[model samples]
Target: MRGNLATSLRRRRRRCPIAQYDRLPPELRRWLAQAALPWSPVSALRLWHKLLDETAGNIEAARQRLDLIEARMLMRDAPRIWGVPPTVPPRQPSPAG
Candidate 1:
């Protein structure tokens, strides 16, 4: 059935390591390094998610202030992949919608 197929697909996708830092700006990387330290497997992952959400919010706010249409455009066009959702709600609906 369709449900079974969807479940199987989800399982396959879950095996892939989602890319959380691939497109991070250098400044954001510096922020993350500072925020996420004394790394243990569990704590490191929690820190990474927290940093990613904070970084995304800051970037979106900057784009709003500067009225940089292209910044919004680039963010809009970026690919959606498996990762933690931002702490802030996304400006647009998710692709899964």
Candidate 2:
């Protein structure tokens, strides 16, 4: 299954029910719809809550943050999976305000 596909993130052998998916925030559901990786509800919701707080409830910002994280993971795994060097530099954290 796609959920069992190899990724930079560790794989978990568990079942995710539709009820779990239905309980996700609408914004997160939309984000997951287009996500390149199949994210489990538990992990996705964990990151969603973290990013929501970090972005001060700005949904779009959280979405972009997810994109950046996925991009970094793909880049990190490229050499191992695809045998190609990463094309982009790792994102640097912004200075604290």
Candidate 3:
């Protein structure tokens, strides 16, 4: 899977097409390098292109969201909690009325 922090840390990753990778701003390049997905470039590159269009090319903020998600995933260790505990009926008054 892509964006696995541990594997990325152990590998020296290069995005396919060095020129394209080189053209990215330094910080974005660093982030991608760290993210290092195991996916094929065809899909991921095309998806990123589409996302850039969808977000109007706000790359930095998207990267920030990625980082936030990654951090939260790392910290997540339990099932998610939900609102509204179940209600139980009060016991009826015993033999009296």
Report every candidate's CA lDDT: 0.45, 0.89, 0.60
Residues 1-97, candidate 1: write the lDDT tens digits: 5667656354543322224443445544444455423323343445445644755757545323323433454456544533544577558866994
RMSD of each: 17.8, 12.9, 13.7
Candidate 1 ranges with C-alpha deviation above 4 Å: 1-9, 12-19, 36-97
| lDDT digits (tens) for residues 1-97 of candidate 2 | 7774667887676765677889999989998999988888989999999999999999999999999999998888878987976479889999999
Arrange candidates, best TM-score first.
2, 3, 1
Model 3 C-alpha lDDT per residue in residues 13-72, reported as the tens digit of each score: 775676666666565567677873433344445656666676788887667665665566
User: Comparing candidate 1 with candidate 3, which one achieves the higher TM-score?
Assistant: 3
